[model samples]
Target: MSVTGPAKPNFAASGRRVFDIEIEALRAVVARIDGDFSRACTLLLATRGRVVCVGMGKSGHVARKIAATFASTGTPAFFVHPGEAAHGDLGMITDADTVLALSNSGETDELLMLLPVLARQGNVLVAMTGRPDSTLAREAAVHLDVSVPAEACPLDLAPTSSTTAALAMGDALAVALLEARGFTAEDFARSHPAGSLGRRLLLHIRDVMHGGDSVPTVPADATLGEALVEMSRKRLGMTAVVDGERHLLGLFTDGDLRRTLDDDGIDVRATPIATLMTKTPRTISEDALAIEAAQLMEAHKINALVVVDGKRRVVGALNIHDLLRARVV
Candidate 1:
């Protein structure tokens, strides 16, 4: 005999129904955000140590993500599984830490088992539970009601809407704390050093620019023909027009060559680069951020820039390719 279920359900309809239920569940959690939410923020802000997140089962998974978000957004935090806490991970929790516990029913056995220990350690326990009157809620220093109207699951047993509510509430807390602490993009980049955002925010123009002898430069009085040779040798497709002391005067590029070719009586070999180059060319400081260099390229509708020093002297040169190679683009 084979196990047969109800008529093949329409996945689309089922999914839509689930979305609708979860939306209402999310809406319900908003009204529950009262003075208790404010108190939880206060406790987290005042913590001398990390924010320790604890939960079991599905809530544990949510707890892990919450901890990660908090840590990355300027709040030092980590997750400790409730079951693991019973087996000695409880030592990780300190009296200076603030504990954020999650339990949809407010009666998870593993979490309840750790209540006395949490109290003994003097950890500020902020409970995110669906049942406000449950044991965990009653024991918590601050209770965030995560109750929902109903589960999106047809059997009302799977942790769907409740998990969504808890996750949203966690996000609310992280964002609130982030704003309170004035966390910035640079601060986040420090925490995510290996990510693309870190590359954009931390890497400076000098780090990737072609400097020293690699920078192609021709004296302002040098002929276009001489500039072309410098451009070819450097392979940057452009050459800076500078004074005898390397002070930036203008820029001549491969495109400038083409435009010069169209004009009458213009000899690439004889015409001074100063006469053909784009005067007052766009330039950036070598200490400027690579992303700033990228923005300059986009804003000016150009591909190359002369990297200058405090004295506006040409110290290096870079093109959009350098920005791309550095992954700033």
Candidate 2:
């Protein structure tokens, strides 16, 4: 007799069960944070050099993310592969640096082989592992136990829950260090000079605003035709109306041109710009952040803003297109 045997387990149901198990494991790891966690933070903070994080396999990926988080949040850190370390990369670890090692079983052969050399070099070792009693944890100055009761894999062989626990522990350590150091968003931006937050915080109006000859401007008494020509020439779609001292009086935009055109019997060349310009147009200081300028443009529902000096004199001009090119939009 041919028998199909037991039906296959529901894959979706199994996935949900695994997720729930990992969640519970993470909660348990979080609950276990106490004096040891504090001690690890203190040790890392006291170090003068970078925090060198090392791991193998899946733990290596988590270590890299942890290093990035620490680096961005005021702590200097980088990842070094354990396998590479044993093969002449060990020179990267200086006596001044602190080493954060990860191994799910707390007994990775590659990592274990380097412990004595690292210890001999007088480097502070902080081990993150599932077994507190393992060789790596016992040899370290501070041990963070990230044990998980079970793996998310149905066969219990994959590094799922254990890896999650390690990642969460790494984040907890980074955040604790961040708070202890009083790191700010501006500090984060300084570390990530290529990111959007960096652009928002570091880019000032002077850096992106069109200035001097590129700025579209016309004297307050100029005819509407002159202002329209200036706007068209500069391609900013707006022109600043300024006095002899360059102090802004009003602004004439395409919107104003449209309104003027709609008015009965209007002559573009004969009309003065001041009579059709929008008085008290939205303006920003030249030293203000680009993000702030973007916010002003967004709130006012306008595409451009006049950059002015402390005396309300127009010095520069900016539009949404400038912001977009600068990645501040």
Candidate 3:
């Protein structure tokens, strides 16, 4: 038997309809946020223990994401399935902990069953539900209304808009808490040490720049040919021209070499690098961020930079390729 679905639906139009419904739902939910939101934040902040998030089914998925957001944004939190909590996982909740429960209908049996236990244990309960009059909301120390205008699902039976509302509310709470705690980007990087953002913010020029004998250097008095040999030996596309004490006097690059070749009168073997090198080259401190080095290159339209200390002595060198290798570009 051939089963024919409804005449070919317009997929793009269907997607747009869903977006329209969800955006309206979010607006409705946003208008309802008032002092209750502030109260929820204050209660969570005052907790001496972790925030334990609990929910069932679709709400459970949202709860898990909410828990992750809270944990990553300076609040210690984790999700516990309401069903599993019945099988002894409830032990994870202590009197000092705050419980964040989610239920679209506020009548999920598993969550309702645990309310008595949570109450008797003296744990503060914060409930997120579509119905303010539901038992879960009634019993909660604070209730967050996440009701939506309707589901984005065509049948209006699936958990679409309601879940979106819950997730948005969860994000709002997490960010508000993040700001209240005075959390910094450095603190965020510490928690996300392996991510690209951490690499950009935590990595310094000294950590990525070529140092020691690997750096291409030539005395200011060295012949242009000698500087070219040093540039080739180090493969940095450029060489730092230094004085007797290794103080950076100038820089000579492939551009300078091309100009020297064009002049015909300048001899690579006879001309001192100091006369042909750039007298005022851009330099950066080794203590600067690798990202800052990238910006400096982009701003000045240069390829390489000499790393110097407070005394302007050459310590290291790095170029755009080095930033790319360090994944800072």
lDDT tens per residue, model 2, 1-329: 89798998798998899889999999899988999999999999998999999999999999999999898888899999989999999999899999999998888999999988998999999999999999999999999999988888878888999999999999999999999999988998888889999999999999999999999999988998898889989999899999999999999988878888888888888889998889989999989999999999889899999999999999999999999999998
What is the Å distance of residue 194 in model 1 from its true position?
3.1
The CA lDDT of each predicted structure is 0.92, 0.93, 0.94
Residue-wise lDDT of candidate 1 within 1-329, one digit each (tens)? 99888898698999999999999999999987889899999899999999999888899999999999999998999999999899999989888899999999999999999999888888889999999999999999999999999999989999999999999999999999999999999999998877899998999998999999999998888998899899999999899988888998899988888888889888777888888888888899988999999998899888999999988899999999998888889
lDDT of 3 at 102: 98
Model 1: lowest-lDDT 10 consecutive positions? 266-275
| Ranking of all predicted structures according to lDDT, beginning with the best and ending with the worst | 3, 2, 1
Residue pairs clashing in model 2 are none
C-alpha RMSD of candidate 1: 2.8
Q: Which of 1 and 3 is ahead in TM-score?
A: 1
User: Candidates' TM-scores?
Assistant: 0.94, 0.95, 0.93
lDDT of 3 by residue, 280-313 (tens): 9999999999999999999989899999999999
**Compared to the true structure, candidate 2 yields what TM-score?**
0.95
lDDT of prediction 1: 0.92
Candidate 3, lDDT over the whole model:
0.94
